[model samples]
Target chain A: MDNRPIGVFDSGLGGLTVLKEIIKVLPNENIVYFGDTARVPYGPRSKEAIIKYTFQAINFLMSKNVKAIVIACNTATARSLKEAQSKYNIPIIGVIEAGARTAAYSTKNKIVGVIGTEGTISSKSYNVEIEKLDKDIKIVSKACPLFVPITEEGWANTEVAYLTAKEYLKELLDQGIDSLVLGCTHYPILKRTIGKVVGEEIKLVNPAKETAKDLYDILGKQDILRTVNKDNPIYEYYVSDIPEKFASIGQQFLKRDMDDVKKIEIQKY
Target chain B: MDNRPIGVFDSGLGGLTVLKEIIKVLPNENIVYFGDTARVPYGPRSKEAIIKYTFQAINFLMSKNVKAIVIACNTATARSLKEAQSKYNIPIIGVIEAGARTAAYSTKNKIVGVIGTEGTISSKSYNVEIEKLDKDIKIVSKACPLFVPITEEGWANTEVAYLTAKEYLKELLDQGIDSLVLGCTHYPILKRTIGKVVGEEIKLVNPAKETAKDLYDILGKQDILRTVNKDNPIYEYYVSDIPEKFASIGQQFLKRDMDDVKKIEIQKY
Candidate 1:
C-alpha cells in the first residue's frame, strides 16, 4: 500500500469538483491539489502556452512526491496531456478520455454533444477519443466560453446562466444529440441550469466522476492504493495567487471549508 | 517632433477599445499595442502577480522604442500603475486617473458609480483618485467580473448581456448615481447594452475617450506630438499567445481589420 498523495491540478478552482469526487472514491488517500489561479482559463491560449503551463503543474506536483496526477481541466487535457504523459514517469490521467468513453456508451441515438472551452473544442480531443470507441457515434461540438465566468460569478443557476446555456445548447439539441458531455470541469457546476435547458430527454455526462473512477481503478490495479486508516488523511491546497479569493470561490466547488490553502510561485516550477 | 510610437497594452483584446481611441486622438503617431492574451484576466489575481505582469508588459513595450505607455487594463492600472510609473523612465498613464476625473466632474448629484473587475474595485484606485479631486462626491463601486467573458464571447449586445447589466447596475441605480465610470476596458464594448440598462438620466463616462484626451494633452504640453504625414504610419499588435484569436476578437473591439498581429513570449520580458 502506497501513502504518496494523488495530485490533481487545474487552471483554477473548477478542478475542486474533480477533487471532491477523488476524495469520495479514495477516502483515505492523501491528496495534493493545485489551482493555477494567477493564469487561468487556459481555454483561449495557444497550444504552446497550455503545454508549458501543464508541464509546470506536473513539475510542482512531482515535487510533492505524488504517485499519480490528474489533469482536471479539459483545455489542459486536450492540449497537453499526451506531452505530459510522455515526459513524466508517473501515471497521468486526463478528463477527455473518460468523458469521451462515457459519452460514446451513454448515447442512445448515437449522436453525442460535447460542450467546452474554445481550446478543447478546437483540439478535437473528445471527437478523436469518442470516434475511436465507436465509429458510428456522431459528434456535435460547441464552445460555451461564457459558462466558466458565469459559474465563477456564482450565477450558475440564475436566469442569465439559463439563457446562456439555452443559447449554447439549442444548436446541439437541434442536432438531435441523445447524450451531452460536460467537457469542461466548470461545466458540471452549472448542471442544474443545463439540465433545465436540455430537459430529461438528454443524458448529461460529467467527466469528474468518470475521471475519479479511472484514477481509483488505476491505483488499485497498480497495487498503489493507500491503506485505509482511521487517522485523518492529509489534503493540501496550493495556488499561484493569494489563497483568500481561491478559498472563497473554492467553497462553492468543494462544499467544504478551505482553511489552509498555501501560495506557490508556479512559474518557478 | 518626436516620431516614436505610443505603446498601449491590456490583459487581452479589451485594450483594443482603448487603442481605437488612441488612434483617433493621435492619428499621425506610430502605435505599438500589446495584449497579454496567454495570461489575460488579471482581475482575480494577486497584487504581486499583477505588478509583475504589468512590469513585463512595460518592458515589452519599452523594447519597441515607444515614447509613452498606457496601462489600458483597469486591473493592471489599479494594482500596478503607480509602481510601474516609479520604476520606468518613460511617461506612463493609466485609465483610473482620467476616469475618476471625468466621473467626479460629470456628476451633478455628487454621486458617481464605478464598475470594473474585482482587482480594480478591490484596489479602490478610482475611489482614491475621485476623492482627491472632490471629497464631496460619493462614489459607489461594483465589480462585474463576468462582463469581460460576456464581451469576449461576442454576446455583448445579447439578452444575456442585458440581464447581466441589469443585475449588476441595479445596486448603483438604487444608490442614485448621476454619472457612471466604465472603469474596465471591456465595459466600453458593452456600452450600448449598459446604457440601455442605466437609461438616459445616468451619464456614462468611458475612460478610453478621456485617457486619449489626457495622452493628447501630455504629448502637446511636452512638445512631443507627432507631425502629420500622408505616408503610411506603423501600427503593430503583439500578444503573448497566437495571433489568430486575438486578431478575430480584436476586429470587434477595433471596428477595423486586424491584419498584422505578432506573438511574443511575455514571460521572458
Candidate 2:
C-alpha cells in the first residue's frame, strides 16, 4: 500500500467540500490540498490561463510527492483535465467525468440537468462525458454564476438561496430531468435548498462524492491505497493567498477546523 | 490644449460607468478605457498586488499617451492611488476623495452611508477622505460583496436587487444617514433600487459623477483640456483577455456601443 499523500486542489475554498468527501471515503489517506485563492473564480478566465493555473497547482502538489491528484474544481476539470492527464505521470482525476458517470447511471428517464459556474457550463464537459456513455440522454444545462458567491456568503438555508435556486432551476425542472448533477464544488452545501426547489422526485448527484469514490477505486485498483493509521490522518493545507478566511468559511463547508494552512506563491511554479 | 486621450482603468468593467460619465462631462476628450478582466475583482487581493496592477494599467495607458488617468475603481483607489500618483508624472485622480467631497457637500445631517466591496469598506478610504473634509460627520460603512455579481448579472432592477438593497441599507437607514455614497463604481448602476430603499430624503452620492467632475476640473486647471474634434472623439477599449462579453455587458454599463476594443497581455507592463 502506498504511504504517499493524495493531492487535491481547487480555484478556492470550494475544494474543501471534495476534501471532506475524500476524508469520508479514504480515512487513512494523507491529503494535501491547495487553494488558489489569489486568482480564484476561474470561471471567467481564459482556457489558457485556467490550464496554466491548473498545471501550477499540480506541480506544487507534485513537489510534495503526492501519489494521485484530484482537480476538485469543476471549471478547472472541464477546461484542463484532458491535457493534464496526458502530461502528468500519476493518475489524475477530475470531478466532471465521475459526476457525469454517476448521473448517467442514476437517471431513470434518460434526462439529466447540470448546473455549474459559467466556465464549466460553457465548456460542456458534462454533456461530452454523458454523451460518451449514453448518446440518447437529453442534457439540460444552466449556468448559475451567482450560486457560488451566495453559498460562500453562508446563505445556504436562507430565503436568498431558495429564491436563487428556484429562479435558476425552474427551466431545468420544466424539462422533466430525473437526475441533476451539482456541477460546482460549492454546490453541495446548497443541495438541501436545490433539492427542496427541485423536489424529491429528482435525484441530486453530488460530484464530490462520486469523485471521491472514483479516487478510491483508482487507488485500490492501482494498489496505491494507504494503510489505515491508528492516529488521525495528517492533512496539509496550502493556499496561494491568505488562509484566515479559508479557515472560517472553509470550516463551515467542511464542518471541521482547518489545520496547518500555509501560503505559497503559486506563480513561482 | 492637449489632444491626447484620458486614461481610465478599473479592475473590471465597473470602470465603464465612470467612462460613461466622463463622456457626458467632457464630450470633446478622447478616452482609453482598460478593464483588467483577466485578474479582476481586486477587492480581496493584497496591497502590493493592487499597487502593481494599478501601475501596470497606468504604464499601459501612458504607452498610449494619455494626458491624465482616472482610478475609476474604489478598491484600487483605496489601496494604490497615492503610491501610483507619487510614481507617475501625470495628473491621476481616484474616485474616493471626490466621492467623499460630494458626500460632505450633500449631507445636511452630517451622517453619510457608504456601500462598496469588502476591500473598499475595510480600507475606510471614504471615511478617511470625508473626515479630512468634515471631522464631525458620522460615517456608516457597509460592505456589500455580492452586489457586483448581481449588477453584472443585469439584475439591477429586479426583485432580487430590491431585496438585497433593502437588506444591506436597513442599518444605514436606521443610523439616519442623510446622504449615501455609492462608493463602488458598480453601485451606481444599482442606485435606483438603492434610492428606492433608502427613500427620497437621502441624497445618493455617485462617485462616478464626482470623479468625472474632478477630472474635468484637473484638465481645465492644467490647461490640458481636449480640443473639440470635427467628428466624435474616439474611445479605445483594452482588456487583458477576451472582449466578447465586454462588448455586450460593457455597453450596458457604458450605455453605448464600445469601439476599438483590443486584448493585451497586462503582465508584460
Candidate 3:
C-alpha cells in the first residue's frame, strides 16, 4: 500500500468537508489539502480561468508527490477535470461523477435535484452525468451562487442564512424531487437548513461524502491505501490566503483543532 | 488642462461604482477601470498580498498614462493606500479618507456607523480615519461579509436580501448611529434596503460619490481637468476573470450596458 499523502484541492475551505470524510474513512492515510482561499468562489469565473487556476493547484499538489488527486471544487471538476486527467499520470478524481452516481442510485422516481454555483449549474455537467447513468432521470438544477459567500462569512446557522436558503431553494422544492445532491462543496455546510426546507421525505446526498466513499473504493482497488500507524496520521492543510481564518473555519469541518493549516501564496507558483 | 483619463481599480466590479460617480461629476473626462475579478474579494487576503496587488493595478493604470488613480476598494485602501500614494508619483486617492470625511461632516450626533467585509472592519480603517479627523466622534463598525456575495449575485432587491440587510444592520442600528458610510463600494447598490432598515433619519453617505467629488477637486487643483471633448468620451474596462459576468454585474454599477469590458490575464502582470 502506498504511504504517500492524497492531495485534495478546492477554490476555498469548502473542500474541508471532503477532507473530513476522507480522514474518517481512511484513518491511517496522510492528507494534503490545498484551499485556494485568495481566489475563491471559482463559481462565476470563465472556463479558461478556472482551468488555468486548477492546473496551478494540481501542479502544486503533484510537487508534493501525492498518490492521487481529488478536485474538491465542482466548478473546476465541471470545467477542467478531463484536461487535468489527460495531463497527469496519477489517479485524478472529481466530486461531480461521484455525486452524480450517488444521486442516480438514491432517487426513487428517477427525479434528482442539484444546487451549485452559477458556473456549475450553467454547465449542466451534473445533468449530463446523471442522464448518462439513467436517461429517464429528470434533473432540476438551481444556481445558489450566494451559498459560497454565505458559508465563507460563517453564517451557517443564522436567521439570514435560513431565509437566503429558503429563497434559493424554493423553486427546486416546488419541482418535487425525491433526492437532492449538494453539488457544490460549500453546500454541505448548509445541509441542515437545506434539508429542513426540502423536508425529511427527500434524501439529501452530500457529494463530499460520496466522493470520499469513491476515493476509499478506488484506493482499495488500486492497492494505494496507506497502511501506517492508526493513532496519529499526519494531516497537512494549505491555503492561498488568510491561514488564521482558514484554521478557525476548518475546525468546523474537521471537528478538530486546526493547528496544522498553513498559508502559502499559490499565485507565486 | 492635462486632459488624461482617470484610472480606477478594484478586485472586481465594485470599483465600477466609483467609476460611475466620477463619470457623473466629470463627464468630459476619459476613464479606465481595471477589475481583478480573477483574484477578487481581497478582504480575506494578507496586508502584504493586498499591497502587492494594489501596486500591480496602479502600475497597469499608470501604463495607460492616467492622470490620477483611485483605489476603489475598501480593503485595498485600508491595507495599501499609503504605500500606493508614496510609491507612485501620480496623485492617488483612496475611498477611506473620502468616506471618513463625509461621515464626519454628515453625522449630527457624532455617531458614525460603518459596514464592510471582514478585513475592512477588522482593519478598522474607517474608524481610524474618522477618529483622526474628530476624536469626539463615536464609531460603530460591523463586518457585513455576505453583502459582497449578495451584491455579486444580483440579489439586491430580493426578499432574502431585505432579510439579510435587516439582520446585518440590527446591531449597528442599536448603536443609534446618525450617519452610516457605505464603507464598501458594493454597499451602495444595497442603499435602499440598508436605508429602509436603518430608517431615513440616518444619513447614508455614498463614499464613491464623495470620493468622486474629491477626485474632481484634486484634478481641478492640479489643472488636469479635461477642457475639450471632441468626441464621446470612451470608457474601457478590463477584468482578470469572466468578462461576461463582469459585464452583466458591472452594468448595475455603471448603470449602462458594458459591451466593452475585456478579459485579461493579470497574474502575469
Clashes (backbone N, CA, C under 3 Å), per candidate, total: 0, 0, 0
Residue pairs with backbone atoms closer than 3 Å in model 2 (clashes): none
C-alpha DockQ for predicted model 1: 0.49
- lDDT of each candidate versus the true structure: 0.90, 0.90, 0.86
Question: Where does candidate 2 stray beyond 4 Å?
Answer: A1-4, A44-65, A82-89, A226-229, A259-269, B1-3, B44-56, B59-65, B108-111, B134-138, B174-176, B226-231, B259-269
Model 1 per-residue lDDT tens digits across residues B125-197: 9999999999999999998878987887788999999999999999999999999999889899999999999
Regions of model 1 farther than 4 Å from truth: A1-5, A27-30, A42-67, A79-90, A224-236, A243-245, A257-269, B1-5, B23-32, B42-68, B79-91, B135-137, B224-245, B257-269
Per-residue accuracy of model 2 over A1-269 as CA lDDT, tens digit each: 68899999999999999999999999999999999998887877778989999999999999999999999998888889998999999999998889999999999999999998877887899999999999999999998877887877787887877887898899999999999999999999999999899989999999899999999999999999987686667889999987335787998998888866899999999
By DockQ rank, best first, the candidates go 1, 2, 3
lDDT of 1 at A247: 74
| Tens digits of lDDT, candidate 1, A63-146 | 999999999998888889999999999999998899899998899889999998877887888999999999999999998878
**Between candidates 1 and 2, the DockQ winner:** 1
RMSD of each: 3.7, 3.1, 4.3
